[model samples]
Target: MKRREFAALGLASLALPALAADAGFDGQVEAFLEALWRLDPDAAVAAGRFEFAPQITLPGSAQRDRQRAFLKHWLAEFENRSDATLSVSQRMDRAMLIAKINSDLWQLDTLREWAWNPANYNPAGPLDLLLNTDYAPLPERLKALKPRVAALPAFYRAAQASLAPNGGVTREHTELAIQQAPGVLGVLDDIAKRAAEAGQAATFKAPLAQARAAVNGYGAHLKRLLPSARRSFRIGAALYEAKFAHDIQSARTAKATYEIALQRREEVLAGMQAQAAALWPSVIGAEAPPADRFALIGRVIAKLSERHVARERFVDEIRAQIPQLEAWVRDHDLLNQDMSKPLAVRETPEYERGVAGASIEAPGPYRPQDKTYYNVTPLDELTPEQAESSLREYNHWILQILSIHEAIPGHYTQLVHANRVPGKVKALFGNGAMIEGWAVYGERMMIESGYGASPEMTLMWGKWHLRAVTNTLLDYSVHTGGMTEADALDLLMRQAFQTEREAREKWRRVQLTSVQLTSYFSGYSEIFVLREQLKAKSGPGGFDLKAFHEKFLGYGSAPVRLIAAEMIRS
Candidate 1:
């Protein structure tokens, strides 16, 4: 079936079960998604709950406790239903819902980021997801904006109350939150300006002013605590392992997974070396290794960097590649193309920078016609040196692979397919592991299908994949084994073969995040293995790459293991 046809079915039948579950459990899933969203309005908005767009989540212990209770009640509901009688897809959903609730419980009880992470208190993420996505008309969305603005003061007040006393928040978290809150006011002003242009300013003016004041005040509250902020951010080995189990939703313990990443790092570097050796001289005007594999590959990669687009044109460079990427995907039949799912390549909004080099903001499942934003951060804000460093970091070959990962056959493509999955609950609560892993796998698949067309492209992908592997190593080592910034930089630069600039940024990123860095490698590893296994079993002409991807994606972003299990059962 065509993608548009499938999407129409999904939109038309969101309330219907994706599989033959105990019919009771299907209603149970929708109830849980709604209950979960009502508690965390930020999540509700992201899930395309336009009704919740105006609600800023109340930041306090009570909220967490209430959410925990909700999770347990629904978790029990799903658990009580017999898996034995369920279809493979229904069984997978059961596992995901269970893992999700368990993960949330761990975070609220053990991880307790709410007490110490000021980043969670930032209003920008929710505000951006609301104001940026055109899920509703400007007038209507601006009207929804009032409640969030009115709630801002209390939101920050709850943040103050919930945060540990005496600046117990991480210095990085506090500093970043303080930096970001002020930006929320700017978004409000932009919205007000838009309202005025649309002759709807009267509708937005009062709340806009009030929201700006609340945001400014919130910034000051954070700024005052900056001096006493704790430098410690590690979640420790025990909690790290638990989070690994929950977030990654895999059986492998954190340490075991880190070891696997370390091994993959070596394998990827070796591949890069082999590719570099063949393309030597032609790449860097040299024909042989420099006795050190790391330096030799770095030299060739440097040549690729020099061939990069200028900083001024970086965003345009990314936009220009989308068509070529789409063309390539179609020509290769890498997967079914979904032209009906609109993807727009655009500059990253001011409030969303510092998070990624590139990212995709897919329309919420409930709001299907809205465009998916392929946000590429422009180099305009960076210093000349920073801009140049970033350009080299995302060089031409690497950029194409990045495009493939973030756009064509990566996040955008998978989400296009995901939105058409009949169950709203599954689409809303997607497993990050499957989403990211599929993108990483897509990168490798594209290269294998001859997308890059050059050894340099393949080598860049090798190095990029190494970054995924090293990310796991870096996260575990820093959080569990007490790896220092110098040590992490060496792991990223020399071992992972990343640019010095890229490695430095990663040091900051690891400080900001935990287990999440590991997802790309872990998910990709399992998905790739699953593909090979299915191929071996299918035999001869039975295996179809396009069909595999479609069916795998059709599962609606469940955990990779569950997705794999469903495929195995089939």
Candidate 2:
């Protein structure tokens, strides 16, 4: 059968109460994912492991042994399955699964964050997932959550055993985990309270207390381990590149991604300089401003950033724009509208704060029918100086483009379309590069299509796009080329034209993350190129932008190259 036919057939099978698949191809894939979910039960809940929600996957040697065995079994299974025997969709699913399994093994055996990062052991979030997703009734989910919460003390004890005395975790990670641990406990405490409100607190009482104690004790475990913590959180070059291959699921190498980003950065910088020069007569006057193009661009972008929302209004302003952004996209017919797909604009969950400005909480592949939260972190926690810096970073013009990136035609838009895909495997193990790339591409797509239709918006888009480029550059440089905090700040604040607070926070982020920072640029580059190819092929008036977008998003969040091949295939 053709790919689309297979996808439809596969999806129909998913709706069945019991797992059933085609005798050969779909059967193998279904069996593998089922086993994988049971093994990694916490990840399973979000990925539609409704049956397994009550169980938490404990971290430690026993868990790792199971993970190892699982990985080896899958690799052997893949070896026996010949591509020639399978349908196209089967081949694609098998390949993606193999890559994911390989990535998992590499992450476990090689990079080994579990050996280092104590935060990986946190079980509070798993229960939160069960509570929030609404795949079942509240009572049913609460029942599922109880066992997971009850299991936390044992989970953390196993996690504690997993940590090395003198290991790889940085002091920063330990400290952050210690701080965030409380917030996680708060989620559990709230769950117990909510259960009490519903007269089910007695069911949650013992586990909730034990879970809170486990979290606090975990915090203490980290505190004791702090002196032994090392600062080298960088996954190093070889592991970084290997992890990138699987996690990113793109053809680009780390070095190639870095080089492309450098070139893209220069391209964006040149565009911003021209934009700066155009506005120079009014903004900077008829005199030579700065010798360097980077500094000159920075000066002009700062002027555009001057019109920002007040610190207090930051969250409200962003919240207020969701409806307006939705309307604008509908007005423009940017993507096929899904009025039923619930997109919620809300405060970033307390347990998930202290990260990027905003992110999307999409339902897992198995549970497609759930609310998608567009989480924007409020600025109430920041100091005055910090708040000012952050506001400057997310100024009025940039905020709209950000809304486009995170909500309108970006993450929220792409994911709604993604959920419509019949291929669960594709959505379960989405290409990070493509997922992030689509959102970054969405920013430019809106500006180019005339949202604001002005130079300032164009300038802000350029500056924001530069962040994508800089992210990759920083990721590669920090891990491989030995970029320092001073270097990172200078690159982000000066050349990238980001605010001081933003630059400092980004420095912290790069250290915590690995090749993930590179996904935005790498995916965007491939996607933008693909769009150009489509546009060129269709020719000016013949090119249907809306059709191109739907086709692009229709493939779900697979690697851009895969989508490109399928969309433009003969």
Candidate 3:
């Protein structure tokens, strides 16, 4: 379904408590939340609540206007309420809801920077989420086809409308959209086949057929629109500046942020170098000569991968850890929610499409059945040399590091809690930096907690950290015109010590995505600083990792500054 519609559905789900609450003040507040939900299905779905309604799809301009109007009305209604009539908890929820709505409204106005990127354009991500969720039965999956399939034409029309006057897409973004298109079609075909076999003509068959035809038509239309897509509109530096301020809600300018991260990276590398010298005195004794950190890390990673089990066995190890991880969350009282459902680890076709090394598909608003997915993309069509390289990279220790990043107290765990957050604002305004930062932080936290006892594990974590550092530097340097792809490759190989294949793949990723590359290093630095500050303030008692994390996540995925404000207030 469309993102807006999913978001509205999420808002609606949060309102259900109002309809089910006890009478008087609490009931009235719940009633208000319920009303907001009915008004915004898109918000509702995003928050992991489902409402029974067809997805709403519209042209980009039209949707923007509609979203603005909805937020205006929603805000007004919230302001009209009297706090005297509500209980304390109800009042807090109301305040949070209003804050969230306002934040999202502001974000909507400033999110034009990403308009040209295909990552935000299409429906493949959501489609994968639906297919991966255990809660979605065959019938439910078929039912979902209506809104998703129906929305294709509008999505295409919006893409066409958003196209530049020149007849080509931005060279960097072209590959992602084109790659995702075939995958989307593949999904549509799968749904169509499933619908036909079920013999359910009304809900499933008709919509599926309509959607399949539309997708085909849309593909043809895209080719026609491709030439016009190439022209660059003058987004101007002012708009780009505004995107950092309003869209990201960040205090740091893009340049300032990049500088801070770069400085921190140099400091970290120096520290690591010192540690390497001390730990391996014979290899790189007291006053060690220049050594490639990337190569050292890569060698360690290669060894770890070899030591671990292959794919299926690796998946089993991850699955086995679920109960332990879940119990850890509960035993420590980390966050304010229950996430008992077992996450499934599977290989998906999208994995092969370069979605990421691994990812978690959180539950949608209308999906009552929630299943968290831990996905690993399998390598396809490898030459003998390539096959050996691929195997070396996917080795057991490396897989474990990946598993920690995608599952455990990482993305899956954090997302589950995030889904359960009561207000639409926190849910809808979720920041990429926070989401990704928390996952990277989780990986390090595990290692610090002694999870990285083996040499392979240490190497794997080090490799990931190097990637984060390299990604941040590349993102800024490439965009600001200070560095070329060759420079980036050299940095990755010489400084980060990545394998030739890994370095090349990362260079391509850096080209394909802009701001996203900065997320890892920026996020890690933000969290690292916050953790240090918290430790200093709390001193002996303040060093509770569980408490700090739960509180950090409770504020929703805002910029680190906002999170700091909330933490201080709490």
Candidate 4:
């Protein structure tokens, strides 16, 4: 059976009502979300649980089911509200709430299907999202573990049922589950030990004991389930098609989307190459092939590192600049809001893992006390030769561009603002394209605004933009099984001007994940077009970089088309 067949079984059209009327529409929506947070404390903490009540224990699956049913019933009761009865803002808030609940329902149902995938099941990903990395004190984290530990039995039982005789559980999934089971158990054990050491309540102590027994039972259950896990099944193409539709959230089929992204990538690459040539005549001698651009970039990086500032110094510089950036936004009245929390720059082991890297770990919807992290990995891991190679590739200009991309006026700042948007549903459906796209867009915007005034800096930014385009092409090529590792490496080396190490790292990332690479080019392209359109539309009114940015982020991270509609309507 194809993957889509399973998706089709779960694909039901979401019902979205027209604008609604009610004097207290906004209040009702807020109350609904507040109630939801109370029921699911993990979500509440994630959504800014610190601001509301103290941390509550997460309920088990049966309790969650009852809560979901109650929400559905409440939504049904409020479904007939018409716009005429409510104020404009209240009506808009209600519509957003309804949309959010529908999206949440879809997510809950879809999660059951993908639950076996280690990416979804392991503590590293979704679990990390809920753990409040930046917010919730250590005591809160310790206290919250009781319910998660308590809930392990129910999770295992669900897994067992899903793996029942002739069910859809695959051998690969079962093997991964088995492999990850020990890690899961270990996490639970760690949590229990921590809670006990912290002198948590008897309520917590009792649950931890129960969790240990349940985990042991789950291990036994897994052995029974493993024997019946099949190598394959008859999931039809229709199901695969449906799944693709839901996952991509676009009208185009996956194949079509891949193709469009491929073509757009080539166009962007050509444009960037032209821009690079014009900006760096001495580096490439004005008529060099696109492949030789990396050598120039490498030389530039090597020169920069020779004079590179220490990490602490660089961070201090960024910290000092924040006040000016923040003031610029306020003076311009961009978005008409202030950040709920200040941004912090941090170094972490995880960020160090990526070869060509930096990342923004933004606050989630439930993460009110969240501190945004702008993580920049050092080049310490590279072999001396690899280090030199990377240095050449990441020159000073490139470093500045990356800083702008990952920190100030980029992902971290943009997301901090995005999280402050008033609606819960908008926050939950945040798309990667908008987030990454805006950052990439910021790099170019800063260059155009003279943030990094040097010709070398401009050229380096062009090179990275070119790489983003190349990434999109390689992602589609490798995943469709059309491009070999060697071919991918050669393309990166030739067109994007990346080192062998950079190329190989990208290949590994593509192998581990699909669809994410496309976001860079897709997002950049959309932002580019939007900027042009905004420029044209505004005329003498002109484009306010601050205003454009604030407005863009205010819409959350939905598709550019939806964002465009919202912008135009507003």
Q: Score candidate 4 by lDDT.
A: 0.55
Tens digits of lDDT, candidate 1, 3-119: 110121111112223446567767777777777767777777766677877666687878777887887888788778788877666777788778777877778887888888877
Best by lDDT: 2
Candidate-wise lDDT, in order: 0.76, 0.77, 0.58, 0.55
Any residue pairs clashing in model 1, and if so which? 281-286
lDDT of 1 at 163: 85
Worst 10 residues of 2 by lDDT: 1-10
Query: Per-prediction RMSD in angstroms?
Result: 3.9, 4.7, 5.8, 7.9
Candidate 1 at residue 150, lDDT?
Answer: 69
Better of 3 and 4 by lDDT: 3
Regions of candidate 2 where Cα sits further than 4 Å from its true position: 1-23, 85-87, 284-288
List, in order, the clash count of every candidate structure: 1, 0, 38, 20
True lDDT of residue 219, candidate 3: 62
Among all windows of ten consecutive residues in candidate 4, which has the lowest summed lDDT? Answer: 3-12
Cα lDDT of model 3 by residue, 1-570, tens digit: 012232211111122113232246445455655655565544444545444234555447776687688778867877777777553334545565566567667557654533555445666555544544444576776566467777777676776676544554564555566666677777766666676677755566556566666666656655555555663422334544444444344547767777886786776566555544344544434554446764443343443445545533544666676666656555655444444554677665651355355556555533424565666555454465664555565555655666666776777766665555454344544566666777788878877877648544564566567677777677667656547778988887767766566677777776664566667666767888888877888778657776677667655455666566555554
